[model samples]
Target: MESTAIGLWGVPLAILAGAIRVSTPFIFVSLGETITERSGRINLGLEGTLVFGAMTAYAVAVMTGSPWLGVLAAMATGAVFGTIHGWICKWPKVNDIAIGIAMMQFGLGLAFFLGKAFIKPAAPHLPSIPFGAWSSYPQIQAALNINVLFIIGAVLAVLLWWAFRNTRMGLILRVVGDSTDAARAIGINPDRIRLLATAVGGSLAAVGGAYLSLYYPGSWNEGISSGQGLMAVALVIFARWNPIGCFLAALLFGGAGALGPALQSVGVSEGYYLFYAAPYVMTLVIMIITSSPTRSLSGAPGALSITK
Candidate 1:
């Protein structure tokens, strides 16, 4: 009986560990998307930016022997991608969504092309705080060996949440998202605001990519992202465009993502591949539950196309 109880507890504990490990990317990407969406722009090309960021980060870390500098390089790369997207989207009759898709392809191609040589080269790893040092269990210690990016992401969420509600810049972003006409009437340059927002968003998303290469999987490859950037878009919707909500939603999705592996570890593996789809299924279900054709979801930006 005691063994059974312990086994049951292990599942949840493992799930929590999974959440901690997996939520970092979600946190960074979703928050970046939040910033872009709030400025009445959407960049589906974040998928590309993420891949490129990962490649750049890995390459920089390997050459410089500094993970932090690699992170900065990734941010710069992401910003450049965002600037290109912003510049092109400003053209008349340009479709941001289509451009995003194109960018995604371009990013993937570039990453694969440049990262081909980096496949075998090892890079310096990011630092992690040992919160589980007090625990005697190895599993607990492993679980607590989380990267610093997680804490930074959490802090950014809280700060963004407060800024969105209390800061002048946040109000301007909200107004722009709600109505370009309103923003113009108030002397705000909607296009400029959106461009800046997208740049910042791209930088943040790249930070998540840095985390992937410098920490988690800790390698350079074409398959580093695995749709994490795209999933983050849906996560933003489920989070109702709130930065704090994005953080919580990320943790939940991260846990669901870890479910398949956790179950397989304890000798229960009936549908291994199918278990991997848990996160997508959860996203679809949540979309259905939260969506309304007649009314906009709570916290959605009015001018954003995704909500409609």
Candidate 2:
């Protein structure tokens, strides 16, 4: 009876907490993916970039004793990776998707080889605001804790959405993404614009990895990410490529990803594992709902390869 009473209050709180914790990575990665896709390219190798980012962040933190620097290192390295991908895909007849896959494998191999020594080192974690301070229950307080990165992501989403609508740079990017001929007619370099966009996207994705290794689950390990990188591709689709939509979608995914654990916390252990499927299920449902036979995804870049 007491456990049930506790769960009545606890489950919702746990899920909320889970949503924040799990959503941070999704937001960063999906936002990154959104930026790249908006420029008419898709980066499947983000999984590799993500893993490599986590490894790089962890290793740098261990060496420098500063988590922020670790994140910066990850961002810089991710940019290099993205730059490589962008440069390679600019060539005639080169496939971006294939290059992404190769990059993913290469990154994974490199991270594993380089990250071996740092597995046991303890790195400092990012600071979090105690939004749960008013709650008397320890569990409740813990659940309400919010991190700084989440704040940055939320603000970033709104900024990107606004930029896409109002900025000249955003206009140029859209033009390039929608039509290379249009870009050429306007004397804009399509390849150069894509290269810059890809670099920014790679840096954003690396920030997600830094959050994973330096914060929640807070460790340097091979199994740290549960395909958040690839899943963000679907997430980008679900968000209709809108930055704000990406943020909301990320929170939804976070809540879903946290559902199983939240249920377990409420003593609903049996069948709780099924709830772990929530994010993937949501992804499928969204995809089905969004699919169309006659047109590309409503907001998708015209030049993007994966059209409906």
Candidate 3:
């Protein structure tokens, strides 16, 4: 794809493509976090899980020559990590947030130590759908290249939003999240539900990591994730714990993050670097806008407020 062939429209088209590519991880992580938070637990260690999952996915893909298998491995490891966090936090007087921080460092160190041999290996990349193939323009073709995971993430968002409202399991999760006493009276174990929710969240976050290593930037590195896991926590909050809102917010964040590269692609390089900070800046702004000391978030679980 030559820049001369792409007109001024290339910039926006490129940004749109970048937004979809960049948003995949955010969508997975934010949706996963929504599930965890809805069950009244927050996993701050997801950054570690995300990175570690990236490493695991790359290593597995290199060894097995199957990107999908690598993704499965990452999900399994993430489940283990989540289960550990849940188990530790269930103990008397244990602090979930503090444990999550410790786990973050632990995951990072472990990944770097184990992934040294995998740094140089080439792995199979995930496949994408060329939505713009009908167009003669190269820029359009490149811009509309949508990956399988992004499509799955988008569908999952809608499914989750619907499930939360209509499913019996969803009702149980909501009840467990809202009040411990109420859950107990209803014969549901809050600890157990939170544990399962956290485990599921961990797996989902890992899938996001797999997408990063197997597609998009499409490589394994220590810095593959730029605090996206942490950013997703605020995103879940900003979305008011709604699954559909999480999906849309991820796209917004993704588009913001993509603004810099999109402009640079069109030869507008000078100030585009500043736009690279869009994701972080947007996260901070949304957090400030949504936070209130006296009132809980509109859709927040009642039990989660005590942690604040």
Q: List the residue pairs that clash in candidate 3.
A: none
Minimal lDDT window, size 10, model 2 = 1-10
Clashing pairs in 2: none
Q: What are the per-residue Cα lDDT tens digits for candidate 3 across 1-308? A: 46467678877897798899999999999998889888888899999999999999999999999999999999999998998988888787888789889988998899899998998889999999999999888888888889999999999999999999999989988998888789999899999999999999999999999999999799988889999999999999889999999999999999999899988987785988999999999999998888778776788898773346
| Cα lDDT for residue 220, candidate 3 | 89
lDDT of each: 0.89, 0.89, 0.90
Off by over 4 Å in 2: 1-7
Which ranges in model 1 have alpha carbons more than 4 Å from their true place? Answer: 1-6, 290-292
lDDT of 1 by residue, 1-308 (tens): 43344566677777788888888999999999999999888899898899899999999999999999999999999999988887888777788799889988998899899998889999999999999899766667777788899999999999999999999999999999999899999899988998998889999999999999999888888888889999899899888899999999999999999888778766786886677898889878877888777877788788776765
Better of 2 and 3 by lDDT: 3
Candidate 3: stretches off by over 4 Å: 1-6, 305-308
* Candidate 1 residue-wise lDDT at 157: 100
lDDT, candidate 2, equals: 0.89
Q: What is candidate 3's local distance difference test score?
A: 0.90
Q: 1-308 in candidate 2: lDDT tens per residue?
A: 53344547788888889999999989988998888988888898898888899999988998998989999999998898889989998998988899999998998889899999999989988789998798667777888789889999999999999999999988988998898889999999999988998888988998899999999888999988878888899999989899999999899999999999988987786999999999888878887877778766888899887862
lDDT of 2 at 107: 83
Q: How many residue pairs clash in each candidate?
A: 0, 0, 0
